[model samples]
Target: MAIFLTGVTGYIGSYLAAELLEQHGESLNLLVRAEDSQEAQRRLWRSLQLHFGFPVFHEHLSARIRIFCGDLTSPRFGLNDEKYDLLVSSTDSVLHCAASLNRKSEKSCLNVNLRGTLEVIQLARRAHDAHGLRRFSEVSTVAVAGQRRNEQVTEDSAIDWDRSDYDPYARTKKFGEHLVRELLPDVPRTIFRPSIVLGDSRRPETTQFDMVRAFVFLGGLPVLPFRPDDCVDIVPVDYVADAIVTLHQSPRPKYEIYHLSSGVNSESFRELTAALAEARGKMKPLFWPELEAPFRAIVERLSRRRDNLGYTASRLEVFLPYLVWNTVFDNTRVVAELRRAPAPFSSYCFSLFRYAKENRFRYPYREWPEIATLPSTARDSEYSESARHVSAGEPAK
Candidate 1:
């Protein structure tokens, strides 16, 4: 039986598609949003090339994939009657990995993550009822445990939605998970929640450079608002893809939620800074708890200047909360199911750093020269001096 997949153009999704094609071969249907089948095929090929960095395997893999150019936000995946019914009858499993990670737009996040998930669930139901679908796997994020700081977030951790300051992306994912559980109570489903997926550990390639790249860029700053011991749970893209594929192939367990995270092996900000510094041959960044207020003030001031620092500062504000996030994601369930543990963040952090630097922290896009290099403005010099003070254990004041 064929496997139906979504988000085949995304970072993790592209890798997952390759893994599935290797395993299933000619029995995978990828749902892509494009103008037509040709564009959809081109996009898929581009994504595979971006991540794999090889053209040899493209022909072999492309021959096996059946691309359906459609949108998940639409009913019947926006396919015509004949195509929709054919899809329902042919597919025996579903892997819904498509989602919007835009943190700034609540409406877009809810529309894609929440409504799109509902559409996937509906498709899963039809596949299950009509075709004896064996599995329904959805990719989710561990961030759904929003704002639950200084705690161990297990697969079954409760989501505290009342928290007013949760990232919109995380909140919508939590709501999407709830909707899945409520609407598909009896389906043989699995929810895999990965934390902070970076580039492939084995390869110096990634489809996107968003969150991880942002953090690496911030490392160049003089002073960062962070705690030395705050853990940042990260897993390599390859490990996450492998774990998800392996779990889907295994016998359906009674417990469905699995955390594809580094878990106990998560790296701290101090360790990450050291690794990045080693990779870049630079001084390790200084972390200061007292710098938070002043850092925000500086960022607000920089935002008004409309320079490289301003752009970076604005982006930094979006991810500042993560620097001090103290929660650790527990991956016991995934560990047991995969019969092994995820590789430690230490082993792969340097590769990611190198990739970010080599690619200029913007994969699949041309690097902007002005934004690439930090300007030597007077404010930047002050920041550098402040960094020196913080590094020497002196107050930033």
Candidate 2:
């Protein structure tokens, strides 16, 4: 039996995948959005390269990982009868990490977040009926909480049908949660909601840069249009991934839903800015809460241009609501279960800020080595034979 995992190519998903591969001993059935076996292999390397070098990844590719190349939005993940059946028969659990985070496009969100999730749920249903799935985990977002304010929200109280969401992304994710519950009521399920996942606390390098660019744009400003005291909940990617992997693998977690957030320990704008400013030996940026309306108007206007400023402004435009919401999701459940709190964002924000600024907001991704000769297309029999040797507690050979 193997854990069917999705979104191995995404930032947080990559972290989760790496953790499971390195620390645990389970065989993973990975769903990669690629045209062929070689493309899927390269994509996985690009994503996992942050955590593993070529040799280790190549070893695992042959021994522990099964790549299922398909689209999440397609019927049966665009898999043929044989491939789909192979996936169902070899799977014992699911860790759904794929999602469309394009907040501006309703079509994208609806098609990917809603339709795509339905496809995964359907697969889980088939696998469950075939041989009783061990668990089904959903990597959701705190944005599903809708438009929140200064209040700290708990897992149960996060979702409110009456409240309006900030964007199409949030709206569709909110509905996605509903779909999971309504469609798979009998399956043992877990939902993880992560808040403002920024840089990894352990390192300055990162593959994901949208949020970092937005933060850099904001950080460079001498005068910002927001309240200084408003708490912005930012959690490291490592903590979020750790919580998800730990709880998902547990025999029985105390709660069905966990908010992987900073909660009350989240830093204020003043504190975060001060840390950045002190690190750079520069003056802290001034905040003007009253100017938020006009600043928003300016951002809207700037977002129309087709240049770099316009692109940055557009990114900020989508994230502006969350920055000013001053809301934090309660992490008491996750903290208690994990026996540790996420490192404060203020402690690591400066390193991320400097790295982003210095690197021009892009990760230096290492390409697949030309000298590498590992075959990407491993036969099903090879994967099945390898899967039989790997168990829940034993490391992959």
| Runs in model 1 lying further than 4 Å from the true structure | 51-62, 161-165, 300-311, 364-397
> Which candidate leads the pack in lDDT?
2
Q: RMSD of candidate 1 to the true fold?
A: 14.3
lDDT of 1: 0.73
Give one digit per residue, the lDDT tens place, for model 2 in 1-397.
Answer: 8999999999998999899999899999999998877677779999999998877777687678898989899999898889999999999999999999999999999999999999999999999999999899999999999998889999999999999999999999999999999999999999999999999999899989888889999999999898999999999999999999999899999999999999999999999999999998999999999999999999999999999899899999999999999999999999999999999998988899989888887888888775553344444323533222232223333
Against the true structure, candidate 1 reaches a TM-score of 0.85
TM-score of each: 0.85, 0.95
Give the residue spans of candidate 2 off by over 4 A: 373-397
Q: Worst lDDT window (10 residues) for model 2?
A: 384-393
How well is each residue in 292-335 modelled by candidate 1, as lDDT tens digits? 78877886677576865566666666666655677778988877
